[model samples]
Target: MEIAENTALVVVDVQKGFEEAGFWGPRNNPGADDNIASLIDEWQSTGRPVVFVRHDSSKPQSPLRPGYVGNDFKDYVEQRRGKGAGRELLITKTVNSAFLGTPDLAAWLGAQGIAQVVLAGIQTNMCVETTARMGGNLGFDVLVAYDATYTFDLEGPFGWRRTADELARASAVSLHGGGFARVLTTREIVDAAG
Candidate 1:
């Protein structure tokens, strides 16, 4: 899993709402921050690329609605303020598809000549999955850092509770089996990045 110099790590919404004390708050994303930091460090050192995708929930009831406290990137990510400025890129969107709703992520990737994307973030079955599918459709080889993504339980159409772990694994299965992405553990990602 060698990371090319043109590779980019697409970090999706890891907002405060998904951390230890917000909407989907739970300490479930094992080694998420660490893995992200490791990858960030490697990418920064190598001058590759790191793109941060933030979800700006535009609806009033959504966790990231404007003026809401949970709208901001969580402490772990936000805490790295003032540093890594030019080395990283930040993009915001109001929908699940980071590529469709935001400034052309695909175009930007093409501009950078990026052929590979390593993904990590929260709400594994939602934004993360959506972006991976879009990235694959756009022809980027995608790798999802499994432990670096998390989600919450919800009552689906089946009337059963979908746990965080369940959704996470579901994303892995769907993305990996659907020819969209490869699901790799944090350790695998870190090693690859290194």
Candidate 2:
């Protein structure tokens, strides 16, 4: 798929909290950050738009709560943040969907004339997936960089447990087959976007 000129790469929930071993166990896509960083580099070089989604949990006990060390972005993300103002847009969200945040991602994308989105982030079944669904429904062309997002293993409502790889596959199938978004590796995305 060809990435349009009016596309933005949305980085979601890639904060330091996800790095806490106890908080997120048995994750897949270990190289997701490297892939994400490559995309960020390409975007920065090409002057493509980029948006970051930060999850600030409302629960006081959560390590991801604001002002906590875990709430800070990882160095890869922080370096981008350090690039200074107007370089990228930051949207803070408490929920699973980035669109439901304080700044209203959907509205901001529309205002910026973003027609297509390339997504890379944490927790495939949660925030990233929800954002893709909402973006698709909102009429934006959405593509997920599979190699640039990771997720932890999960226990299902039926008491069945899934490995991280299983969960990632399920999410990919759901997002692509459900018509929410296309799934591609980071290289494929960069080449397509190019």
- For candidate 2, the 10 contiguous residues with the lowest summed lDDT are 80-89
Write the residue-wise lDDT of candidate 2 on 1-194 in tens digits: 78876678899988998888787788998899999899887776667788888999999977789999999888888887635323478899999998899788888888888889999998888899999999999998999999899999888798999998998899999999999999989999899777
Global lDDT for candidate 1? 0.78
Clashes of each: 0, 0
Q: What C-alpha lDDT do the candidate models reach, one value each?
A: 0.78, 0.87
Write the residue-wise lDDT of candidate 1 on 68-117 in tens digits: 77778877677553355334677888889779756788888888778998
lDDT score, candidate 1, position 13: 87
Return the TM-score for each candidate structure.
Answer: 0.89, 0.95
> RMSD of candidate 2 to the true fold?
1.6
lDDT of 1 at 62: 77
